[model samples]
Target: MLPLSDASVLVRRGDVPSTVLDDDLVMLDPLTGQYFSLNPVAAALWARLERPVPVGTLIAGLLEAYDGDPAIIAGETRAALTRLVDLGLLLVQPEQAE
Candidate 1:
């Protein structure tokens, strides 16, 4: 598994197709014939993932759009994105080390 940080770029898996109904996202991985759903917050993140997005961008957006502690938002987003990556619903582009 890859470590996802603020600099990591996240994008929806190209081979996977997704459907959105309200705030929920249903992802179907055709390769494995598996499907998964994301809740409202995760769904919103998924929508933004139509293109590659930096993890920091996501954290900043959530912080400004919602009322929550910054630390908590970052942690939760990282965890959720990790799971999505593991499930093959999302892809991660690791940040280049300086």
Candidate 2:
């Protein structure tokens, strides 16, 4: 399953229609026709959308980018990921053998 912090996806609008801008690490939902920007950390996480990463890994990445307490970063990352799930931007992946 995708980590809670790595749950959200980024999307943007297109001339023809909404499309998943994977190259740009963004996705556009046709229904909303709105653009969403993924923060640097989120953008990095989004780049690995195809692969499901663990919560600890995501937090570690963020911790590298921002100097702060690991616990606080972990909590915030989880909350951000949860918000993305609520927005229908992220999907939970079924666990698989590594």
* Candidate No. with top lDDT: 1
On TM-score, the candidate that comes out on top is 1
Pairs in clash, predicted candidate 2: 10-27, 11-27, 12-27
Off by over 4 Å in 1: 21-23, 94-98
Give each prediction's root-mean-square deviation over alpha carbons. 1.8, 6.6
Per-residue lDDT for 1-98 in model 2, tens only?
34443333333112322234644445555456756666666666555444556656666677888888888888877776666666666565544455
Question: lDDT for model 2, on a 0 to 1 scale?
Answer: 0.57
Candidate 2 regions with alpha-carbon error over 4 angstroms: 1-27, 96-98
- What total of clashing residue pairs does each candidate reach? 0, 3
* Candidate 1, run of 10 with poorest lDDT: 88-97
